[model samples]
Target: MTTSVIAATALDPRTMAAKGAIELRQVRKTYGDVVAVDGLDLSIKPGEFVTLLGPSGSGKTTTMMMVAGFEDHTSGSVLIDGRPVDSLPPRERNLGVVFQNYALFPHMSARENVEFALRMRKVPKAESRERAEAALDRVGLAGLGGRRPRQLSGGQQQRVALARALVFNPAALLLDEPMAALDKRLREHMQEEIKTLQKSLGISVLFVTHDQDEAMAMSDRIVVMKDGRIMQSGPPEEVYNYPLTDWVASFLGDTNLIPATVLERDGNLAVVDLGSLGVGRVRDRGAQGEKYAVSIRPEHLKFRTAPVAENGGTGELTSSTNLGATIRHRLSVGGHDLQLRELSSDAEAPGRRAAGPVHVGWDADKAQLLVLEG
Candidate 1:
């Protein structure tokens, strides 16, 4: 299928507002005795696509609600373009919100629904109609504006909801799992579309999702939250490659966490003792401690015929699973189970199996040394 390019002129000038720069300072939300958000501090630049990523009950949604003016924050301030809007209502905040359910009016046609926000703002009928059609066209739903929510497919309905959000030209867009209802393929397609559209229109977006892959794919910067506080925040690649905590390392992607004791440190490199396995060097960023955990991505582990170097460790290949593009192997090393992933093309033939003794190794530079935390 051919993908259509979104034009710069897709957004109507009258409706389009300047991109928003959002800042949340010491934001905290408490529900009686329980705190949902704790001293959260975040800043999103104008036209930047930032994602709040975490597991359920991590306060991602609550932070978005406070920014959208849907839920009142207990303290701190939410500033859009450097103006505090803590007491402002949702409508007056000029922030577009798209929920997981799409939240479309069942009885209203697509065009009408897209124009509803304009109507509430007292826009003239003729102008509202023109802007609504333009918004629908921008989202590739031009000719289907007359269809109601039930008449459109799930993806189409989602497009209509997005059109409605864009019709008013919000200063910023807040999306809370908008593609959660779609299938995997459709969700991926929508993710690309949203990213393209946001870049073309130069609108700030605060996207909230629990899907790590989706967040990594769409975000310019990712803020990882846990227990109502930020565990780490940085560019997608930086956060994934250098996680500050074990939780962030484990949550962002699959990893092998090996317990080790730091023997010595030399600049950015640290020599660590992996009990019963062997000694290895890893990238350590000034961590002064005896106990540490080494994080290594499964893909980095290479299966060797025998111990190759200082980084090599002997293990028993317990099992292997064929996953089409990749082969996943389970190995037992030093009484701990570790996973090793290799490209299918690089793996042995499907009929051939290597059991018993095996060697696993990774580059010292690729391994991350993290301080063990409670």
Candidate 2:
């Protein structure tokens, strides 16, 4: 892996041009014949929390490395605040970065670790110490800066890493799986902390994570990548509810995809035949393909006593699984299995209401007809 410095410029935070916008124009990266990132174009507006989400080998981390100047792109440009920084060194890019591992120096105190960047830049000892302490305090580590990485709790060590990254007052922050090493509880807690801190400071953030829930919870927008290219980019709700392709629908969350034969189309709405589930109108986002599928999230499937004017029909409940706070019910309509998830608290839920023969249905607005990509 290439070594890239976590960074900042010497300019005063208040006086520097505050736009932390990041834009990647037709950027591509390749190692021999294998393309790591393929003609990627992305933009992060200042103060926006944008997340690059995908599974392993999807090139999310590679994109971040390119943006941070850790890996030079094979083609195209990277701009920070509308200015091209393609030739700048990692340090000169002035972007704070945190990684999966906290990477704190075990031999140094938390304060010393946070002070390392400033010290390397030849800042006066008194100012560096003062700034490091304040940065630690900002991340809720007031007096704990005296503790070394090994002496701190996992959450504390994470805070120290955050403090160190923010101590430089960089224009933007890039986090590559920053919470991967922490436990679930700590990860959630830190996610909130990081979001709150980002909003308070109004700093642009480029986050990389494979966790779908985390991306949904934190991002203003999510860029879903697959095979080194973007599959979809939109608000979490939009992407999750209305994925344009089969791969995207399967990636974001649990969804019931019913095969559909497109009978006709009028504008963005298509009237399709779903066989036994009956003919229904669904959202058609101009996807060019010979095959199509209607995507309805498990949570959106409701147990209607009678079929409504939507994609619904009488179905046999094959089995019901109690998933603690939520219940998952498997229903068979015309040999097509559909998964329905309902909250235990809902009185009309399948678990609460007796199973066996039940009418399964979902509103037309809740169903999205997307392309069935090969």
Candidate 3:
């Protein structure tokens, strides 16, 4: 983990209170007749890590641009703390922005690159050097200050960019897919480092990414976007396990969606018939629609010798794949292809993969009935 000295210099309550809050009220953006972002209302609390996640052209990037003052909104207002910042330029927004490409000047050394921000702000040369070197040290690049962007590793270069953004002590950090170029292992490493730094500094972060796992791993809250609109926003587990729409269920992660019919309702719980999967009770959000489906994540599915008392059925195992920590099994149940994942350490996992009848089951609470918007 990357440690920082910012804890000693943590911003005061008044400064955090003023710079920590980022809010967009009915913010909309358009290009002639085409809408890029439609009525996005979001809030990033002080010290909170909020991610805007979606596919390409989902307006997640556009929304971040607007917040950073790079793009102008056609309607609604953008506020920092409680004051409007719609008229502020990107530089004037007091936000530390790290772009997808770690935009560093190749001509300058890491120390020089980090000092450029303080230089632009007219800090004295001595003060700029002191603060720049300190910032580099804070990001675990203390001795590499003399290296140019080309001389540093991808991770080191990212540190320089972060140091530059932090040297000025901006209130909030705006990260736009900052880890997109790194390899999978490196990207995951940087995710941990960035989250650690954010918590250490106690700064608000408005992060944008299309990678669902990335959002789940780093964000305090996930704001899912779809076609310029927000589909769902909540804690990672809540949004992933209890998505309101089938689109969200599939987008967040792999899920086995089973067609279901609401047989009865009791308050927030509903007893539903799963046809071949058997009868089960699931959460009822009182969604109004005739199209209903139960979403069960592959990891939550279980295998047993007999059908579960509630939601279980006998199925033919088609194939099984050893996926490192877990084994993935595909089965054909009632003409529908369903998959279940079991930890590799499970005693019964290997037996289920053997050539025999496969009995599949899911707990009642694990099945989530959702409205199919499509």
Candidate 4:
């Protein structure tokens, strides 16, 4: 492989002690006629924990492997600290990679496994042992260093693999579904640990995962990908609360989508007619059109036991489910289906007494209007 170094600007003082920033420009990977990544552009600031999240067959994992030098890109560039390294070998790139499965050697003890990298790099025997012990201790396996991989539990083995990754102190750490194997409870605990470790060490982390909640909980920023392309990239709150498109809105969480149109605009609010619900006013900002989809979260709807005439809208209880603190009910409103989640102690389902029709209404500001995409 051939590599050429280009001059890069000096690092900022705040980011001087941490790993370098990474940049990918128009990066594409193709196998025969199939394209895994299509003109992907991403920038990761120094010491940032960025997650690449998407469904199966999205290009998240492929992009990460290219950064680790494990897979070659069909075109474009991969730069570290502003220096292009598309042609460099994996070892020369100074990257630490953690796979989903624990890739520890069966014959080597935990301490020996962590020490192997240092030994291969020609560190003195005494120095190797000291570094290995320190790494094991850092991962909470100080006393279990003598045990082999088979003797340790799955979580313990993962910790050993983590220790091994940190032993060499690479410039950046690449994790591919690192928490996929562990049970739900243990996975939560490890997520916190991993975030804390990344912050403390100030290492640049590129994490890939298919789990939406896990990505939202652990990452500082998320890059949502679909069909071999990036759909959106931003802070977790921004991506969750202010989605750029309707596809993003529906994928992130449970929402009640209602068909509506813009009635009129005044100041920052626009009044909308919610069909059979009522001629209720809604906030549409400035959009006015014939067809639109209004999105409201299920938890935002308010249900009441009053008559349909007394309440603002008409609703009929179609189904009910008990979810501990709240009772979830699916109400059919004319042609649309709305989900109402209410505190059980606050109000019971309106159908118990044979009430012919119940009612529910939502605040105008709680609605989001999604226009037809081009």
Deviation (Å) of 145 in candidate 4: 1.6
Lowest summed lDDT window (length 10), candidate 3: 4-13
What is the lDDT of every predicted structure here? Answer: 0.87, 0.85, 0.85, 0.77
Best TM-score among the predictions, by candidate number: 1
- Residues 246-290 of candidate 1 have per-residue lDDT tens digits of 778999999999998888888889898888768899998775554
Among these predictions, the greatest lDDT belongs to 1
Model 2: how far is 237 from its true place, Å? 2.0
C-alpha RMSD by candidate, in order: 1.9, 4.7, 2.2, 7.1
Compute each candidate's TM-score over C-alphas.
Answer: 0.96, 0.92, 0.94, 0.84
Flag the better candidate by TM-score, 2 or 4. Answer: 2
Q: In model 4, which runs have C-alpha deviations exceeding 4 angstroms?
A: 1-17, 263-291, 304-312, 324-327, 342-356, 372-374
Error of 2 at 309 (Å): 7.2
Write candidate 4's Cα lDDT for 1-374 as tens digits: 00111111111223433665788999999999999999999999888889999888899999999998999999999998788989998777777778888788999999999888778778899988888888777777778899999999777788788887777777777899988999998787788777867776777889999988898998989999987899889998777765555666676666777766567667756655667655555545454444676777777787655644411477577888889898888888767888888787876545572357767777767766665444
Worst 10 residues of 2 by lDDT: 1-10
Q: Using lDDT as the measure, name the better of candidate 1 and candidate 4.
A: 1
Q: Candidate 3, TM-score vs. the true structure?
A: 0.94
